[model samples]
Target: MNETIGNIKSRRSIRAFKQEQIKDEELQLILEAGLYAPSAHNQQSWHFTVIQNKEILDDLNESSKEAGKIFNDKYIQQLSNNEKFHTFYHAPTAVIISGKKDSLMPFADCAAATQNMLVAAQSIGIGSCWIGLVSLVFNGEKAKKYQDKLGIPEGYQPYHAVALGYKKVKSTKAFARKENTVNYIR
Candidate 1:
């Protein structure tokens, strides 16, 4: 297989991370890869906020806890008890992907950008996890502080976030794909 194809096939979601932080140069490359993702009508309405400060990361975790409180679900309540259950998964660096409020293709565009970042991270031996919990807090008052602190503008909303760091363990097993999910036109 081609190197690029191998990287794509080997990429996996890493929830466990090493304590070491990702280098600035490598992080920039990952962000640049995300920026190169295709956008609808070339709107390129996505904005990425790279967070490296531990203080801000802790605050974001607190906000996630607050947001989880609004839900009556038992599982959500349980999440609050897990001190390590941060929206950014305690990674040394987090990249928040935000999109314009009025864009119809915001979610799609942001998703592509995030995937690009993930693949780029994997290719460089860095681990990344796509975090949706932060986006869940986007509409609530609890997220306002994070939005402001992260420099997300008024007209933008966070759609997704990626936690980047060194992987603690590497899994060699490929995931088993479920059948009946795809339909062929031919």
Candidate 2:
């Protein structure tokens, strides 16, 4: 198999990360990878906001938990109650992927960019995790204030966030694949 295939097969979701920040050059390459992801009409409607400041991240974490409390989801409520729960897992950097709310395929476009970032991160020995809980904070009516604080463009909305940093503990376990997933129609 080719190196790219090997990288794809070996990628895993990383939850633990070291305090050290990723190098600027490496971070740029990862961001570039995201920029290269296929988009509808090449609209490239995505806007990536990379946050390296620890204080801002801390605020986001706290506010996300606070927002979680308003949700009826048992999981969200439970997570909100846990003091240890952080949306970004304390990673050194976070990239928020946003797109125009009116776009026909904004979610899918942002998702592709996020996946590209993830694979690029893994290939470069960086750890990454896609954070979705922030949506809870953004989608709710009460979150408009927080959304403004995030500095997302007026017409755009964030679709995903990715935490990036060096791994504190490498994931060595292989994931088990479910069998018979495909239905061949030929």
Candidate 3:
């Protein structure tokens, strides 16, 4: 099998992360991968906010969860009740992916870039998870503080985030892929 395909097959969402931070080189590569992701008309309207400081990380975990409280999601409500829950799953580093306002297909561009970063992280033995809960917090007035804290560019809105760090426990199994979801016209 091709190396890239093998990597794609082996990658899984790692929820538990070690305390150690990812190496600078690995972080650079991951960010580069996101930058290289194809964009609509090559507008490249995405911004990457890397948070490695423990204090800010903790703030993000708390604020995002607090922002999550207004949603009707049971899981989110449960997370609010559990003091142990960290939105980033205790990852030592987080990269927030935001899209520029007025950009064509900003969400799509961000999604592709985010997937690229996830694959790149996996290729380098780092664990990663795409987080949507945090985006919820960033969607309304609750976002102002984080916007300033993360230094999100004035015209950009954070669409998603990825938590990155070494895995506390490597996933030993891959779930079976769902079947009958594809169609062929030829």
Per-candidate Cα lDDT values, in order, are 0.86, 0.87, 0.90
Q: Given candidate 2, what's the lDDT at residue 153? A: 82
Q: Write the residue-wise lDDT of candidate 2 on 1-186 in tens digits.
A: 887887777778888889999999999999999999999988888989899999989988887788788787999889988999888999999999998878778898999999999999989999999997776767867567866777888888888999999999886766788999989889
Estimated TM-score for each candidate: 0.91, 0.93, 0.95
Query: Residue 30, candidate 3: how far off, in angstroms?
Result: 0.5
Ranking by lDDT: 3, 2, 1
When 2 and 3 are scored with lDDT, the better candidate is: 3
Alpha carbon lDDT at 168, candidate 1: 85
Candidate 1 per-residue C-alpha lDDT over 1-186 given as tens digits, one digit per residue, 9 for 90 to 100: 898898888988887888788899999999999999999888888999998988888888787777776766778778866776776767899999999878779889999999999999989999998987777678787567767877898889999999999988884567888889989898
TM-score of the candidate numbered 2?
0.93
Q: What are the per-model C-alpha RMSD values against the true structure?
A: 1.8, 1.5, 1.2
For candidate 3, the TM-score is 0.95
Predicted model with the maximum lDDT: 3
List runs of model 1 lying over 4 Å from the truth.
72-77
After best superposition, candidate 3 residue 72: deviation in angstroms?
2.4
Which prediction has the highest TM-score against the true structure?
3
